[model samples]
Target: MGTVRRRLAGRALSGSLALLGVLLVVPSLYSPTREMAVADREHGSLLSHQWEWSWGRVRVAGLEGVELRDQWNPFGLAVLVVLLVSGLAGVCVWLARRVTWGHVLGLVTVGLLTGRVLTTVAERLGRSLGEVDQGAAGLTVRTEMTQAGSLETVAACVLVVALVLMGVAAARSTGRSTLPAKLPGTPAAGTAAAGPPAGRAGPAGLRPVGEHLTTAPVSFDDAGAGGGGGGADTPATAGKPGRTP
Candidate 1:
């Protein structure tokens, strides 16, 4: 039950990351235009300036038409790449279910794709700390990060974090039933089974069980009977060898 839950959680997180990348790509694809601010014109009326942000282009418009334009749209290409990466990763994540290598592969794909997206947005589109307004040559200009660009940057960060965490979760939940690895020729658990056979040559170089004995432990009476008589001149009658005279 626990394993199933963990697998589901990991898959959900991976899918969410992919979806986030796609969401970031959506706004970049559309490239919406909005009014930045209204400035004073030569007449008694006010003039509105438009800020156009889209994939592959950005432009500033005044009363007449496009006054300034910048074609340096690195964010668009970056987001598109992230989109594709997210899709590929999502597929890998689903297909490789319960496989450690698959999870790792999906994470790697996401890592490669989203890693650059954040940097691209920060370097190209997200410049101002907040909104900035400046006046030059009787024209007022407002500079700020677009909503879509901000979202893209945020989504990239989230995707990276999600992939890292997913890897961790998978690791923790793995090998629940597997036993600890042991070296070759290791004995099984139990004192009797692990010990050496009785009394030949014990473990750790211990001596055998009765190595000092040269004869059987026999009584003097039994020895006399086996000798055919209880004679006084018998070897047993001479008493034990270690006795005092």
Candidate 2:
């Protein structure tokens, strides 16, 4: 009963975790920019040249703007990053269950740092394109846009829930036996090499007994003795002898 209860609890936990993951995973894909792009494309509209960002000249007279601003979703980005990092962590934990929470945290931290670096690089590249020459003013606008927190917040919330679920799932899956079975000191089951405990003989070790016991000599010894038996009252004659031979 206890075993069954534990299994049921674990299953429930895993199910909840998976549900959270689904919720979070979806938000990462929810980029408002896609809708904005579709809208722009559908209308065959172009960005107003006067309206620009940190880089400036957002649109040419005849050229269409890519609506990069509309695509900006801080919450979505956060969720996406969290989902990706957690997924990678989960896979690593699954493949090598020895991984600790610190390991997973480190991975997430590094991933976030790398993402920041990339975002900075992108921002720099955007500036180089003369799209955001307004400098501080443009940066403020971009910051505000990123912080608007609507769709992006929802995505982030989902992502956070998913991450929590993944963490719980991973925790439940961790144990000594969860590690790769090939590790040293771990037994390789169902093979002859699986011997007995150290310093002890196993079943196969007793085969020597069968081979050695069969070679016992039953013949009488004392070949050097001569004229020792004094007829039927001899010292060696104790049991009844047939025909007194």
User: Which candidate wins on TM-score?
Assistant: 1
Error of 2 at 5 (Å): 7.8
* Collision count for each candidate, in order: 0, 9
Q: List the pairs of residues colliding in candidate 2.
A: 33-71, 54-132, 54-133, 55-130, 55-131, 55-132, 55-133, 56-131, 56-132
How well does model 2 score by local distance difference test? 0.40
lDDT of 2 by residue, 66-87 (tens): 3333324456466556655655
User: Who wins the lDDT comparison?
Assistant: 1
Candidate 1 stretches greater than 4 Å from native: 1-4, 32-56, 66-79, 82-87, 90-100, 124-126, 130-132, 135-138, 173-245
Error of 2 at 237 (Å): 8.8
Name the lDDT value of residue 79 in candidate 1: 67
Cα displacement (Å) at residue 201, model 1: 24
Cα lDDT for residue 101, candidate 2: 61
